[model samples]
Every structure is written in C-alpha cells, then in structure tokens.
Target chain A: MNINHVDLAGYLTKSLDADEHRQAEEHLATCAECRAEAESLQEWTMALEAVPEAMLLDGPPDDADLLLQRTLRQIRQESSGANRRRSTLVGIAAAVVVAAAVAGGAAVGRFTSPSDAPPVAQPPTAAVSSGPTAAPGTRTATAVDATTGARITVALTPAPGWIRVKAAVAGIPQGERCLLQVVDKSGKVTLAGSWLVSEAGADDGTTLDGSALVPLDQVGSVRVVTEGGKQYTSVSL
Target chain B: MPGFRLQRRREVADEALVRSLFAEHGRAMLAYATQLTRDRAAAEDVVQEALVRAWRHPESLVNGKGSVRGWLLTVIRNIVTDQIRARNARAPEVRESPVDVPSDEDHAEQVVNAMVVVDALSQLSTEHREVLEQLYLQGCTVTEAAKALGIPPGTVKSRSFYALRALREIKSLSPAGTERSAS
Candidate 1:
C-alpha cells in the first residue's frame, strides 16, 4: 500500500509504529532528498558512536562483588609476582626513591644557582642497557625539530638515586622551550615537567641548555617537548 | 574450546560451568550495570551480586540460546532501575556529559559535518536537548525516561519528534532556517 510521506525527522526519531516506519523506509528508497538526509543522519550516528566506549561508564556505579573480585584478582597477581621477585624489586624501588630525592635536590641547586655561572650541572651522559645493569643508567632521546637539530640527554646514578635531563640544540633557532615526562616501569606516568633555555647573549639557535635532576625510580623515560610544538618521547626501564 | 562446550552443555550437571559463565560475561555485565546505575562503584557491586546470584541458580538458564551475558545485562538493568525508583524523591544529578567522538583525527570534511549537527542541536531548547540526550546517549527508552522524569511517555515521544525534526530541517536549510517548527 502506498503511504503518505512523513517528514524525515519523525523517521529518525523512531516515533512511528511499524507500518508508518515501513512506509517511510519505502519512500526513502525512491526520494533522493530524503535518502540523502537519512544517509547524513546515519553518518552522524556512526561518528557519534565512535566516541570512546569509556564515556558510557561515566555515571554507572560498578557492582560491589564484581569490583571485589577484580580487585582481589589484581592483588593476588601483584602479591604473587612480588613474592617471586621481592628482593630485586625492593632494591630497584629503593634505588629509584633515592634517585628521586637526590635528583630533586640537585634540580633545586641547578635552577637556583646564580644565572652568571656557566650552569655547572652537566647534561645526563648515561647509556641505555638491558635488565637493570650493575652499571647505573643511561639517557637517550631524539629531537623532534630535526632541522632545528635539538636533543635531550638523560643521566642516572643508581646509588645516588638521581637522574639528570639536559637539552642541547645545534644549527637551530635559539630560545626554544623543552618539557619532560617520565614513564615508570609499570607503565605509569611519574612526572611531567618542562623548561626553556637560551645561550648567553646569542641570537643563533645553535646552542640551548637546561637541566633537571629526576630520581632514578621516577626516571623510567624522559620526553622532550620543544617550543615549536614538537614532541620527542622515549622510554627506558 | 572445552570451556565453551561445557558452558553450552546444560545436561552435563557440571558445577564448573557456573564459574565459566561468570568469567566470560563478568566485566561486560559490570559495565552495563554502571551505565544503568550511573555509578561505577555501585554498578560493580550490582554486577557482582547478580553474578553470584546466577551462580547459585545456574539451572535457571538451561536451554537458553542467549549467553549468560544477556541475562546479566537484564538483571543489572532491573536492579539499577529499582534502586533509582526507591530513591525517587531525590533529583538525578551527577550527569556526565554525553560522550562525543574524539576531536583528534577528524578530517576537515567530518569536522564540518559534525559542526552542522552540533550547531543545529545547540539551537534546541534545553527540554529537547535533555530528552534526546537521555534517549540516544544514555540509551534510555522513552518509557524509562518518562518514569524517571515523572512525565508521560507520550510527552517524551512528541518532544523527541519535534527536536529531531527541527534538527533535520536545520541541516537541510541554510543558516537562515532558524524558524521554529509548529509541530
């Protein structure tokens, strides 16, 4: 049966019963404008649906036993792993903690020092290696602005429990800004910080220097973000 | 494969199937429960209680084509609805903004399309916006939303009708088409 046309909005809202909806669907098949409108609505719906599913979890409260079970499972796993590698994990954790404290203190010193002195703190000159070597630590990074040729270096000392982050630019513009973030062993972000450096009375972008001492435990990875809106991220654990 | 088969077999009289069902659908059900309750912590508790309840009555689900997951979603929904009703005197607050598509990675064309819809929706009255949001974003049926709002289901249906029509017309017409419809 041929049915009279309803406006496109009624169809999208799904207010019509089965028969009316079927009629609208039939009309849409032949009507170009309605068909285009329907397609656009569908496209909009699809795009909205692509929003992170995490958004739906916004208001709903988690059920109690489910939360308990999940929590218990996570705890059991962590405990078992901890038991298996208690000694080594403890040593590493302590080292990182110590590194953080010393590095934090050294950072205060480096930043607070008289601006006239040639920033005595050296950029970290550490090397990257596998499995928490007997030798302390290393820093590595690449500059995002390659034409600007910027680089950030990180250095670590396990016993002293400090990590140093330093940046240098060669053949690029001066007064560039840099920011840092550290990702820890368990994949948690431990720190996010930034600073800018400029050579003394030099207009050339060739040389920039700034440094921070981050504790080794908090030094899983260091990221450098430049003022020209470039990000250089790296990880070590 | 063995676990799937065992969960499928209602005739086996096996105790382990209960645990298997719980493991498979537990997290998803918890997510649904949270949406229904709009409280993450409470939803988790509801899911856990529902699963434990199901575990005690595994035979209730025998000869069912629907996996244990569907049953959990239903149970969680009912429980949350009941809770909301029991606290009916209180206003519903703590609404999370509706989830929208990520702004990142959208091409210029998609962005323009989205802006069209967004601009039209923005022109809607708060009443229209709230009803549409509840229905589309929160996935609430008109009846459910009416009960929550202490309004008639017909009101929700009509409001949704006008709101969507206005949105469609706005999309079709030029920016000059700001005239409100009589519908």
Candidate 2:
C-alpha cells in the first residue's frame, strides 16, 4: 500500500496512534518509495537540527544581541500595559527600525586616537566605592567589533538586586545616542543607562556607568547599542 | 502598601520565569529563527515576536505539557511563515518565479522538525553530544571523531547509534503546526 502525504506528515510528527505508527514503521521498512520519502524527511530534520550549532560556530552578527534585548523590552512593555493595546502596535513600528539597524550591518569600530594607534589595553575597572555592598570579586569581559574595530569593556560589580556596570567604549560613531544593556543568564536584559557619544570622546574613548536590575551572578553579558538598537559591541561576563 | 508588595512579588516571579525560559532555550530558538529567515536581523525579529507572544501567554509556556523550547521554536516557525506570506503578498512578482521547490507548508513543517531535533540534541549527554557534533556537525568519520574525542573507534560507532536512537525517542517530536494547536 502507498503512503499518502497525510500519513507521512502524521508519521513524521508522531500524530498517529500506536497501532498506526507501528504499521507505518513496518511498511516503511519494506516499501522503497515510502522509505525514500521518509529518508528525505529525516535528512531535512538533521539539517535543521545542525543549523543552530553551525550558526553558533560561525559567530552570529553583533546586532543579534541588540535585537534580542529590544524584543524583550518590547514584550515587557506589552505585558505591563495590557490596557494600552494601541501603544503595543506603535512599539511594533519602532521594532522595524531596530531590525533595519541589524540588516544594515552597522560598523562598530574602535575610535582611533592620535595618541594611540594600536588597540588600547586597559583592563575594565568598576567604580564601586559609593555603591551598595559589592560582591567579593569583580568580573570583567571585553569584546571588539570585527567590522568597525570598536571596543567595549564591561566591568560588573555584584550587588543584591542590581549590578553596577562600568563600561569603557571606543570607536562608537561620534554623536550617536547609545544605551548600555545587561543581559542576565536567562536572557533577561535591563537598561544600565544611556549616553550620547562625544566627538572628542569617540576618538579618545569614554567611560559610562549604569546599573542593571539583576544580581552579578545572574548577569550573562553586557552590550553597547545605538539608540536605534544597533549593537556596537558585546562581551559575555 | 501590602497590595503593592503583592504585585511586585508577582512581577518578580514572572520575570524569573521569562529569564529561565530564555536561558534554557534562547540560543536554540535564535538559531532556528536564523535558519528559517536567513537573516540574523529578521531571525531576531521572529524570535523577539515569539518571545513577546510567550510573555503575553505565559501560562501556555509555564503550564503547558509540551517542551518550552519546542513551543518557542514552533512560535518562531509560525511567525516566519506569516512574514513570508506577507512578503509574497506585497511583492507578487517575486513569487511568480517560484524559485524554491518546497511549498510554504512543507518548509514550515520541516522547520518544526528541525527545531525538535535540535532541542533533543541539547538533551543528550556530553559524550553523546560530542560524538554527534563531531560526526554530523563537524563532518568527521568515526575514526576521526574517536581520535578527536580521545575515544576508541568502536565506542564512537556505538555512541553514534545510541545517540540517533535517543533523538528518535524524544516524545514531543510533533510540530506545533499552529498557535491554537501548539498550546
């Protein structure tokens, strides 16, 4: 007996009941045509499964982090403002701009200063003297944008409900409004703070301070993104 | 003040749930979306939308019997499908060529299966994952994988067989075809 598309779908999805599933399996073992079709489906399934790991190996574009952050923020807004349905629609409009930033592949190079031709080697330091109690050890990570050569160094000091983030960033486009965001282990992101890049500071690099509403341990990474939601640089912490 | 405290507690709980969901499955979901859309930006958009949808219907995610990763991937699939349909509608000229062999439904189903398989892969043991990763992901022969993983050739073959079997046994392998059907 020939297996139809519906049966193939059922078999592939495991929607078939036990008896039918067993029969389909038995039939597939013998029928050449059905076996070929099943093999094709299985091959596609394997290809699909391999894609994610492959992409990870390939290194996802920088803006990918920014996109996720903006999306989470939008979702939070929608959930909290359930009554303001119209505003949610407006948020969708704004998401398009964010999407465009990612698609355009904005360059995030390090600003070259007359004093320093090579990449700066300063370790990120946390200004925790005045903040709430700090965690025992400071954690830091730095990432450079391959395209723009922009660099961002994130220094995280653990706190109870919030972690103080001190970032030193260079190579951001002068005068672009940018935000510092912290993504927790669960992929939850909080706005650390926002700042405008100064023309002189862009060349010399600038330091910004902010705090995320998550403890130090919960923090996964820190990212610098343009006001339009294009990620300049990110470093896993 | 007590009422405010209760609301804050609920908010914290919800936030925690969201964070946990992302931590466990965010990478897989992003990869699945990236595959479907072929553009990191568009993929991010799909993931973002699906996540927002998840937030709106947190109960489906937190309480539903299906795997959260599977559910999230399914949502991403549907969103991609909608975007494709919208694009085709807006520019019928592009669809006139019919460059792709698989119909939208077939592609969508394949995507669902792919996500399920990826999620299953994540559940495998480190050894199982390593064997499969070397063989399938890195295109290594059994001997090559064994060499790379510091295992014997025979063990590599055996591990590969069992890993495949384990992948086949993942119970929630069905594609969540639609939003209504997924829940």
Candidate 3:
C-alpha cells in the first residue's frame, strides 16, 4: 500500500505512535526503498541535533562597519601572493623545527601526530621513533626569513589565560617598526607587543620577555612582522 | 609559481567570495561570536579571525555540503572553545592537566552534518521548512507546532514525511552561488 509513504517520515523522526511504528517496521522489512530512506534519515536527524546552539540568533548588530573594516584591512595587509601560499606553513615549520633543535629550546618536528617520537637529528621525513619528548607546557620556535635576512626565536610558557613569551629577535635593520604577534591554531593573530629595532639590538639581537592573551594550548606559532605586515620570520610552536 | 595575472585573478575571485560570504553570513557570524564572548571588542576580533579562516580555506566552504551559515557558526564555536581552553590550560593548580582534544574528525563531521541539514532546510518548500523549524528547531511537539502553524496534527505528520524526503536533495550552492543569492 502507499500507506508506507504516509507514515515513513514520522517513523524516521521517531514521532510515530507505537502502532504506527510497528506497522512501519513491518513494511520496512519488506521494502528496501523505505529501509534505505529510513537509514539515511537517521543520519540527517543526528546531524541536525549536532547543530550548534549559536545558529539560533538572527544576525550581527546593525552597527558592524567598523569590525568589517578592521577585518578587511587585516586581509588586505596579508594578501601578498608569497605569504598567501600554503607553503608558508611548511617553510615556517621546517625552519623553526631546525632552529629549536639548534637552540636546544624545546621539542620540534613537522610530524603532527602527538604520539610520534621526539624530533631527532635525522631527515625531515624521519618518523620511526616513539612517543613525544619532554616538556610539560613550554615550547620554543626559531626561524630565519631569507627574504629579509632576519632571525627570531620565541619560547612560550603557558599560563592559565595567557602565555609568557621570551623572544630573541635579530638581523632586522635599525629603526624598523616590527610587531611581535602570536598566532593560534586557526591563524588568529593576537598582538602581543611591538618594538623598533635599535642599532645595538639589530647587531646583537634583543631578547625580551612579554605576554600574550592567547592560551597555552592554542599557540600555533609566533612571528615578527614589519608594520606593513611583511613577516620577517615566523616559527611554529 | 603561476603567472602574475593568474595569481591576481585567483586572489580577486577569492576576495569576492569572502565579501559575499560576509554579506550573507556576517551578521549571523557576529551575533554568534558576540553571544559567545559577551564583549563587543573581543567578539569583533573573533569574527574577523573566523572570516580570515574562511577566506584562506574557501575550499572548505565550497566542498562543504551543509548550510554555509552552519559551517561558519561551527568555526566560531571552535575558536571560542580554544580561547576558553587556553584560559584553562594555564591555571596554576591544573596547569599540566591532560587536555582531551577532540579529534578533528569529530568536530568536522558535526559541522558538516549541521551544514548539510541547514542547507537542506533552506531548500525546503516553505510549508516543509516551517514544519521542521517548528518541530526540530523550536522543539515544538506535533500538536503544538500544528497549532502554531494553524494546521492539523495529521497534516504536520504527513508534511514532515515529505519534508524529510525533500531534504534528501540538498545541494550546497555557495562561494559562487552566494553572489547570485545575495543579489
């Protein structure tokens, strides 16, 4: 009977009466099409349940232009083709991982799985080792940008809501306006602080202690970039 | 590297996609972020960061099968969760506590499924969408939803049956289709 189509949706959503449910199951046992559909509906409903609570709201406030402008300005500044390429991640990771090892700062490697052994003095692809190395919460990253010939290393020590940033920055020209920023797992940049390189600092590199509002667990990397948004160096944590 | 012109074209196309996405979903994204952070300035920062992510990974938006708004909302939720986690990770007492990071697959599935369902809901005929929105989103019982919609309970049941079927035809049209829809 076409009766199945009439009640199948109710059955799929579990809104069926006891009798209706029993009858629908009886039909589903015989009808492949109804059974297949019921199976699919099960997934969709579960997905529906997983929808986050925040989607219920209508939208942003009426006055949102300033926020939009800030966002657009950020995108425009970082839109350069060289930095936009995804290779920047791998490049930053490789350089910082190597530098971390040289600085004897913290555990560093490109292999993402946390279970992979500590980075060893082997090729970049080497991953035959065991569990991750020693370090409770602190991590350090080191990087040198070829384009700008700048050297920077940042070590992060996690606090509860913030982090302690100990960074050694060098090789940038004197009086260059540079900002020290912390980036999270999703590429959100939080301005930690900024400094203008002095002649002595450029030659000897300045090591400064600072703090960032980012959490310890989310710190993906730290970077020193010019006031114009050109990154001098970025090292992954 | 691609030719200068080709790269420029891709960037422009990407920019357009981001702008449209903002035009369509920005208010909603900001609303969600503001509610989560409870601070206007911080919420703005969160929305900007989420938008940046969308701009960089437009592929996620294009390849996603759910409602684009749903996907964007999911990203906003994640960014907030990380911020909260960051705050918790450094507590002096529990500083070194083991954090059970949810697998990427877990959240991705949740986000994508919600996306699909949201998109599917939007594509539904008004009658179908109204019924589901009342029942699922508003958590109204069949009798209650029927009363609210000025329809009979039996009609609600029958409508839901067909609505579920119609939802099976979800086609995620965004990042390009977004432009047309916004117009």
Candidate 4:
C-alpha cells in the first residue's frame, strides 16, 4: 500500500502501523520529504542524548522516597475511590480512569515555578518614612515628619520570617543616626532598633544598611525615627 | 498451593519486578531525574517518585514494548513540574537584593557542565531542545510530545532528527566530540 503523507509523518515518528511503516521507509528512500523527516528525527534524538543529566537538578534531595511514597499512596487512594464510585459502568469508567491517571501525572509537573519575576522597586521614601506599615504588597509609602521638615520615604517587604524596611531622607543630614522600629497599626512600638547613616538623599543612592527578620508575632508596621529628631518614616507591615 | 503461600509468591514476584527495574535503569533514571529537577535532592525524589508512579501505573508502560527508561523520565518530569508549581505558589515576596554571587569555587563543576551542554544544545533551536526534552529526557513518546506541545508527531520526529545531528556536529567540534567522532 502507498503511504499517505500523514502515514509517512506518523511512520517516520514511529506513530504508525507495520505496513504504513514499510511504505514510509520505502518512500523515504526515494522521496526527499520523507527522507528529510527520518534524518531530522535521528539528529534530534542524538542531540537529546547529548544533554548532560546534571542540568536537571541542583542536588539530590533527601525526600525523594518520601514524596514518591506519598504520591503513590495518593494515587492509590484516588484509584480506589474511583473504582468504588463506578463499579457498574466498567468500559466508560475505564476511559475516565485512564484520563484521570494521566492528569494526575501531569499535575505533578506543574511544580516548577519560573525562578525569575519582576523585581519590586524600592521607593527612596520607603527608607525614610515614619508612617504605619502599609498592606502586604504595597510598593511605596510616604511619611512626613512635621517637626524636622524632613520627608521620610520608606519601603517595606515581607521577606521570609522578617519584614524588610528601607528609608530615604529628603532634607535630613545624609549621615544622621536613626532608630528603626516595627510597631502595630495602633502606634504601639514593639521592636525598636538602630541603623547608622549609610545613605540619604537622591545622590546618596540605595544602600543595604542592615535588616532583620522579626519574629512573625512582632509588630505589624515599621517606623523610622532619626536620632537627631530631624526626620522620621513609617510603613505598614 | 495454599492460599497464604500463593500470596507470598505474589509478593516475591512484585519484589523481583522492582529489583529488576532498579538493576536495569536505576542510575540512568537518577541522572535523568537530576537533569529534569536541577536539584540532587529533587532528582532523587523524581527517581523515587517515578518508580513509585510506574509501579502504581504499570499500564502506562504499555506492556513490554515501550522503553522503561522513557516511562520513568516522564514520571520524573511530572513530579518535578508539580513540585515547581507548589513552590511558586507558596514563595514569599521579598525585596530585590542582589543574589549572593557564589564564589567561583562553589559552582565550578556546575558551570562547566552547564556551559558544555548549553553550547551543544544552543546550536539547535528552542523547538529542537524542547522536543528532545519532551521525548527523551522528559520521557514522552513522539505522539505524546507532539500532543503536549500542540505539534504534529511528524514535526516532533523531524525536529528530533535534526537536533541530534546538530548535537553530534557540536560534540565533534568539542574535544570530547573529537574523540567520539574519531570512533
């Protein structure tokens, strides 16, 4: 039998039957299109084998056996559930069961999160703000210290187990000493701390002065009060 | 045979089957799992999970026809994907601080491996690596790879063919390739 184009394609990929495969090979010997298809498949498979296995994982995890056991148990549980639910419609139910099995495997793959996401911009004021902490996902907040005529801009982020705070000054001295405090929304100071003047002013640029992951049970918002009492900044946690 | 003896025989058979699989492709499966997950720990997990998955879904192996290695890789990829999704969902947002650049000594081997593989794979198009990953490393059949990627199986096969050729050419260009090519 002559090989149809689809047959040639399928056969070339080992997705077709015996007669079709023979027809495809026979045609491929003469036909440029089919020949090219066969050649490409060979090359692709070779390149794939060339890929080093090391790129796949950072290091061997200790939890492999545990996860596998858990997954298998979960799979068995679901299989038993399905079997119990539809002991009557055996044929149709088999198809559903197979579909579910495939889906479960696929579900396991959706695990890799893209490692890179857009970086959140830190407002200069976040480093200097004297206001209560903003909500979770707030990017920037402004706080004005009327006493010192210093506008403290602050930014806060919920890092793992710690709230990160940054502040910038508008009119305050660049090297002024300050106390950074995390307080509840009710203005009750909880964790009070100090940071030396590593940076201030737009020209001074952003600096990694210091940060601590506060206990989760600590205050909700962060407030910065300059030792000189010249400027202050605060942001909600 | 007594009923209890018959049950014991079945258990022995199952154990033998598992052992045979471990002997046949354990290291290869481990390597493939490592590649897919990019974590040694996760790789081990993938291997274990794949084996468990294979045991649970023996029908997926298509009797004795399909490659056991390929089937295992598919299981590994699936498990890795699920883990990645869960990690992403629970990942906490944090300030953008520069990632601590590892000391050159820390990732030297990794860097070398990455460079070699990337150099070889980069010769092929994204489509080529992707198809190869799905078919070989990820352990999908041509049909399955095509279906997952929304391409024709023919395309997948063709892509695979060219990708391998390009890789061989690249390998030949490298010192390692020179040795293999001379063979």
What is the Cα root-mean-square deviation between model 3 and the actual structure?
21.8
Alpha-carbon error at B12 in model 3, in Å? Answer: 20
Interface RMSD of each: 23.5, 15.8, 17.2, 24.1
lDDT of 1 by residue, A81-184 (tens): 44433212110000000011112211100001112312222111111111121122333222222222223323333335444444332222235565556555
Per-model TM-score, in order, reads 0.26, 0.45, 0.39, 0.29
Query: Model 3 misses residue B92 by how many Å?
Result: 26
Summing lDDT over every window of 10 consecutive residues in candidate 3 chain A, give the lowest-scoring window.
A121-130
Error of 4 at B84 (Å): 37
**Poorly placed runs, candidate 2 (over 4 Å):** A1-49, A54-63, A83-237, B1-20, B86-109, B122-129, B169-183
Shift of residue A49 alpha carbon in model 3, Å = 2.9
Chain A of candidate 1 compared with the true chain A, TM-score: 0.28
lDDT of 3 at B105: 24
Which candidate ranks first by lDDT, i.e. highest? 3
Q: Give the TM-score of candidate 3.
A: 0.39
TM-score, chain A, candidate 4: 0.31
Q: Who wins the TM-score comparison?
A: 2
Reference-based lDDT, each prediction: 0.40, 0.54, 0.57, 0.43
| lDDT for each residue of candidate 4 in A59-107, tens digit (9 for 90 to 100) | 2223344544454455445444554342221110000000000122221
User: What local lDDT score does residue A57 receive in model 3, on the 0 to 100 scale?
Assistant: 27
Q: Write the per-residue lDDT of candidate 2 for residues B67-148, one digit (tens) a residue.
A: 4455676788878877766665655665555555246546665555565555455556656656666666556666676777
